[model samples]
Target: MIRLTGITKQYATKGGMREILKGIDLTIKPGDHVGILGRNGAGKSTLVRVIGGAEPPSSGTVERSMSVSWPLAFTGGFHSRLTGIDNLRFICRIYGVNFDERLAFVKDFSELGSYLYEPVGVYSSGMRARLAFAISMTIDFDCYLIDEVMAVGDDSFRERCKVELFEKRKEKAMLIVSHSHRYLKGTCNRFLLFRDGAITEYEDFEEVYAEYKLLLEEPQKF
Candidate 1:
């Protein structure tokens, strides 16, 4: 289980401090699969990062009893100077996973071929995304944080990711943030609607989706 209490995130701007998340309190259990819905700049990604421990909240406490993953396909965690293979080795070492055992799987899944031997700085966005996704699958985590890049590569690769993360790891907890309601409808059992630095939870996907559409139509009010 993961619990966040009184979570608030702020960023310094020229004018003053800008608050992204305003006193958010959330909890995620082992089997929870939640989809976060929000418009651009609604702080959905910020909330995910905070929950994943990648970013610190300005004022909050995060308690985690289960292992949590970094946001899927988050290239910021990579070392630009290191080769893809080397980066994978570093990650494996940190997680105490057997690098040799996961090497072939990541290689086959990423399909980077010779590019895997090249520095990550030189890889294109798609290649980086592929490497990130492959490495993520190689490690085991109790909870996975997924942003908008679930459909990272081609259709076939996307299907492979879905199979690996959603099908095979069906029991793992997931927090998915995406603009596509159709995609979330199939993957998530619950919904979180983020608006104006706050969140509203809904157990029914269709109900929240309707509210989200309404929010989209009245962005000025929000």
Candidate 2:
């Protein structure tokens, strides 16, 4: 089980001090699939970062029963000048794992083909996302924290992602961030809406999604 208690995150904006998360409390059991939704600057990314341990919350605690996967994005840790193959080996070295097996998996799953030998700095954003997803999947984790990575995949890869992530990995907990309602509804079993520096859990995704859409349509009211 993953439990977050009294979590609060504050940021210093030019205008004034802004509270991103105000006393968030949530529990995610094993096998839970959760989608996090919010408008821009609503602190959805911040919440995911805090839970991923990339940033510490201003207050409160996040408790987890199992190891959590890092955010699925190639922008972090990956050296731009390094080739994908080299980076794969590098990541394996960091984890002290045998790269021979997992490296092949990442190579094949990324579908970069011969391009995997090229430096990542020359790769497009879509290519970077694919490599990130491939590496993350090859790594073993009890829970996953994703942020906008799903949107970068192509149609076929997206379908494969649905099968592997939502179907095969149903036993693991997941917290995904995406603006695509179709993707969210198709994968997540529950929803969490972030707004006004707070987080709210909902059983009905459509209801919370509607409220979020309203907030977007009328930003002045929110």
lDDT of candidate model 2 versus the reference? 0.84
Report how far off residue 40 is in candidate 2 (Å).
0.5
At residue 61, candidate 2 shows an lDDT of 96
Tens-digit lDDT string for candidate 2 (126-161): 888888888888888889887887677788987777
Structure candidate 2, residue pairs in collision:
none
Task: Summing lDDT over every window of 10 consecutive residues in candidate 2, give the lowest-scoring window.
Answer: 213-222
RMSD of 2: 1.7
lDDT (CA) for every model shown? 0.91, 0.84
Reference-based TM-score, model 2: 0.93
